[model samples]
Target chain A: MSQNNLTSVVVGNRASISKPRLGLARKRAIIRFLFILPTLIFLAAMFVFPIIYNMIMSLENYTTISIATGNAPFVGLQNYIQLFQMPLMSQATWNTLEFVIGSILFQVIIGMAMALFFKRDFPFSTFLRTLILLPWLLPLIVTGTIFKWIFDQSHGVLNYILMQLHIIHAPIGWLISPNMALISVIITNIWVGIPFDMVLFHSGLQQIPDELYEASSLDGANRWQQFIHVTIPLLRPVLAIVLMLALIYTLKVFDIIQVMTGGGPANTSQILSTWSYTLSFQDMSFGQGAAVGNIMIVISLFFSYFYLRFTKES
Target chain B: MPRQGLRRSHLTIIGALIVCVMLFPVYWTVTSSLETNTQIFATHPYLITPQFDWQTYRIALQTQLPHLVSSLIIATGTTVLCVLVATPAAYAISHLQFKKVTWLIVALLISQMIPSVSLDNALFIIFNKIGLLNNYFGLMLTDCTFSIPFNILILRAFMQSIPKDILEAAYVDGAGDLRTFIQIILPVSKSVLITAGLFAFLFAWGDFLFSVTMITQNSFQPITVSIYGYISQYSQSWNQMMASAVLASIPAAVLLILSQRYITAGMTSGSVKG
Candidate 1:
């Protein structure tokens, strides 16, 4: 639980160097054990057990009928081998990469801009900040639903606006076209992601001392110069952490893409999540779905290791 | 005077541009929601329509009100469960020096980062086996898996910042650990609790993929799934879908506004990451 993690780190600090008596330390440790044991058990039962069971299930051909008849057969690594053979599975992997990279780059750049804009003492910055939260605070399904409407081929607001502004003479398909569906989903995702990144970066910006800017200015630094020499370096840690977390999150995104496009118009928008769902639930290929899931876990673990190492070094 | 005038003009122009770009989608949603079905499909989307209609809102509300209720129940249930379970665990980790606590927290973090979609097939099997697939408790349990780690991390940061002497004083007064947590820690850490709960509510509410996979019955489906049924590949009920999305987002938006202060602080503290 949250309490144990905090207390453990604090206790691990070892600043109480006077060294308390063994008897007292033992008593405190006992209390700590008693407090945390319940949580560990709960996690083991609900999380660890199911995951381990899932791993086993991945090696076997299990289904509703298999469960009913107790006729499930162990398949070993065939599930993973099937993954590479399936074209859709390979496509899903590629799509996951595209979604993660595209979403993070756009979200971070726009977020950084918004953060800088809001850092100023504007008249309606508070109102703008609240408005920004609208996209993020709304449920992913809701946002996807709204975006689905926006991308509608017929009677879609996007086409309507484009015509009125003379931007495009003909109605452009936003989601229906195989090429445009993924991009439409990406735009909506960027809208949803911008708020979290901006707020974090904005707060990070505030933590940087104004005196640094003043010092830079006195040394003949212009706005761009001050930003390059002062702001970027100062915000690097926050930026790095935010970028890494956002990349990890966007990689696994599911609800929005599914609700909006259903990985449809010929599965152009399918990512790992939807692909996994389709493989296991829809196709009754539980083993393949587990392989996809395992792939996702491995990728995320790789990113987490890199992130932790980077943070430690800094 | 010249420099001031130029600076003012530059800010005004840039600010106006930013506002236009940022508010366009939201503006489009609200405006399109008010338009008639025919007008919504019009090739050129007009910012100001000839007429506004509230019929779509009325229809969506009348037809799918129960689904809205389902969403509220699931969100509230998941948020309450995550906070309750995560709070005690977070408290222990922050204050207790248990063996292998660091590795435990690391495991918690890694568990959170794993995509929920990956678990769908396995979870489906597990739920089907237990006869819990269509139940609210099943949804709540799965949502808790995704929520507890982040909640624990944020709440732990807040609890760790509290002076240890205060806890020792409570101990000196013969206050039990539970008594101290309930009376002292909870009160001081209210903001962090609220922030964590807000995220829990948001995640539970917005999640569509799991809700659709877990609940087969139309009556038990959440608002997200209900709204999803309104759209198709060829043509969608744009007016109704937008109206439903706007309506669904209201509660979450209000929650954010109400806890704006804590939300900001929670973001800052989370990034500090001991």
Candidate 2:
């Protein structure tokens, strides 16, 4: 009878001790929630709210009403359909495509060349590598303005230099000409993009084993053979990442074109980003601007999905 | 044997030529910034050295770059706030076993994919409605929209490599989650925090689209829009323009120099194969 009573007393004591420990664990969980509260609040106000607001704006004929009023008539898909009919819209889309393809191709080609050149570990290589980042390091506003001065028709530095060299009989109106304006923009983009690609590719190149190249050469491989067989395969994943990021950066380029031409000589150089800005602010077609922006979002989402998918597969 | 030597010399010469061509645009900008307007108009523009005038630097220094202070304040505030807010959030994502975490990450990724241009029009309207237009707090909040997702992604990767037993041991020692995070996780992850801070700083500092769209007044504008004001469709202020451009590059250049190691390390984190 005494042993049974002692056992009951010990069991009662154990239950009381465990209760407070469970309470402590619950308290810790609640504290963790509080820690994350500020970030959640920030996202709700800035990101989540704005996204919901944009979707609502896309469905209305907000052209006639002041945005401050926020009482525009709903028009369903009218803004989106009308967006496809605008000539500048089509031209802007085309320009964006050309910009992406052209910029990516040249940037990759030239960047690869620089990567190969800088990979030699020669004297002044580190200085040369750092110096090459100057174009990218400078503000885009500065780069665009410098190029603007360089491309000036009469009494500008570019024309003056060309004439001094006797390279051409007369000056070229680089910005005013529609055909040349986009390419001029591409030249600047290429210059800015080369540094990023060089850095990424150089990192990729450094990871490649010298032993592989030595073995290839010993097996009667040429310079081109080593690059094709050994280098390309090793750098494939890095190349994919570099190209995807470069594409995203190029797609959103606005400040340079805005500063250089104001999308001028008849809006020839306008990409989707600048076009959307002009529509909303300059043209006061808020709904149409929202529509254009939606389209850009769709394109970005599509490309990002593909990139994510590709990354997962590889 | 002679042919091989010739080929090697040919490659070196070709490489040198490409480097010069690659460097010409940037070289031209710095050199031109030194030249006077009269010299710039000269038929044979000097590429190397005819004269050096530090007048542009002086003008850039004295021109009352009104937006620089606002930019510095906003960028610095965003960096500090983001590091404080994101460090714990990233730790939770990496270490904790919460149910809704993956969905949160996916949502963040989707938010990032949606371009800033898409949100600009709506945000302009929203800010105008709330009377938050031209407010630094409003702009900083918007920047965090991009910065948080990227910071979370980068930090999670950095944190994943850290062993979990350290935190588990801390938990067994009667310490709570908060104490473990403060003492164990943060000290070890300082480099990654600096890396994320650099990215956030540069993005907020150099952004043109959000600043121009959200902030309407000239005085409220960042250096980007202010610099654009110096250029017009017809007339241009070459001297003041270059001055503004030079001034605008300073914050970003300073950012790059201070965090050069972190930038290189951050780029190689996922890009290069181990």
Candidate 3:
């Protein structure tokens, strides 16, 4: 949307052509700069400054005691070294990988399915499509909390339904079990994510011309073949964006997992974000938490570079 | 025609089932909110409320009203701040030329990738030093880190589409940049502005990271943090917890239904995400 060529047709010219006087135009330019100055300053204070601060904190021996005593002595790489050697950091690293991958793969697949299903001309499909987006709109905290209820060991709706269906003979503690905690959060994330992916994919699906499908069908192509050859190929642009964003956001999964499991059952489910919080607030190891946070940022920046590349390409 | 009608029913059934499965949590939330704690915890918890009880909600309101009000203030503050800062920046980016607009855009995009943990990790120190801890204004300021750029991008996308002729017309009438923006540009871009504002509000309202990290004081916390505390503190209080969840969802559900087109527009805009 920002790259619309038509958007620049006037303004880039108006700044020069509209004003004849150089001094007056210069004055106008100053005023225009003033408009955006606040945002620039705010972003700097909020993100840029804090990001730099995080780097500094990661190197220093900042902690709860540091806040009180104001004696955060500079420690070169001890925080990083100690955190690396800790068992929690290793577990969090693997868990973060699983959480990100598990979420994006499932959500995109399920979301595309939902999107394709809704694209059909069916009774109340439009209404139901909107209804399906409720999870995405609700707060992550709300989603995680209620899901914690639904995934409860004995009283959970999930276990109850599975047991009733004879799929499981006994109740499973979704959040209590360390391995299941990761799986449970992934499942909840997929539910929250499906609507977003579906919405994006649904729009992408809408843009595919009907003639292509009809032509394929006429060329002796089955529905499945048409989907594989035409639909998947054409939806590449949306797919790229959806995948990039899902990866970026899933990497930052904190509130949901924090509320759902708090990386519980002996720290089995701790991801980098939750681990960072645990280190800083729970453990009072602010320096280690900052180090973990820097690691997360590095991971995000790595993906964001690709995201920017893809956005630029398309 | 009858065959087509039959096919539609089959599709409708599928669609309805999907809706039920996807929305079961929301439905269960409302139902569970209206049931007693005993009924909610019992084996084979009533799928539907046997009695439309208001006791839990009454209790929830007693505890959560202040938290809700606090959340409202913070979210509102964030939205207002976001729009105020973003509109001009978006306008400048779209209408005014900078030395390196692409650089600025890239910078903003990269800023989005800075995880909340890093920001909170540092902001805790900064806020603590500056005496902003447990402060409403501090939380609002932190939440703006999210909404500002999101609104800027969304608004810039819309503002860029506003025809040059409109601004040219305002200029021909001898109106200045500020006047033209206030008189011509703003009224024309009202819907997008509203969309931007709505999503900003939702972002701040749904915020848990900043809420939990910044404001630890019990008297001044949002529903998200409060509900999180409730879940662990009173693990058996499913009825009250669900009631609070329902309360937390009221705004999203209301906005989802009432502003369907705006919600759809905002969703596609990639305003808020994972």
Q: Which candidate number has the best TM-score?
A: 3
For each candidate, the DockQ is 0.50, 0.45, 0.64
- Docking quality of model 2: it rates as acceptable
Show model 1 residue runs off by greater than 4 Å: A1-31, A164-166, A312-314, B1-20, B43-46, B49-52, B232-235, B271-274
Model 3 scores a TM of 0.96
* Model 3 steric clash pairs: none
Predicted structure 2, TM vs. truth: 0.89
- Scored against the native two-chain complex, candidate 1 gets a DockQ of 0.50
Candidate with better TM-score, 2 vs 3: 3
Q: Where does candidate 2 clash, by residue pair?
A: none
Residue-level lDDT tens digits of model 2 in B19-111: 687767656766776777787666666767487878876775565357887777777877887777777888877776556876776666666
What is the C-alpha local distance difference test score of each model?
A: 0.77, 0.76, 0.87
Residue A67's lDDT within candidate 3 is 97
Among incorrect, acceptable, medium and high, the docking class of model 1 is medium
Docking class of predicted structure 3: medium
TM-score attained by chain A of model 3: 0.95
Candidate 3 residue lDDT tens string, A268-304: 7888999999899999989989999999999999999
Better of 1 and 2 by lDDT: 1
TM-score of chain A of each: 0.89, 0.88, 0.95
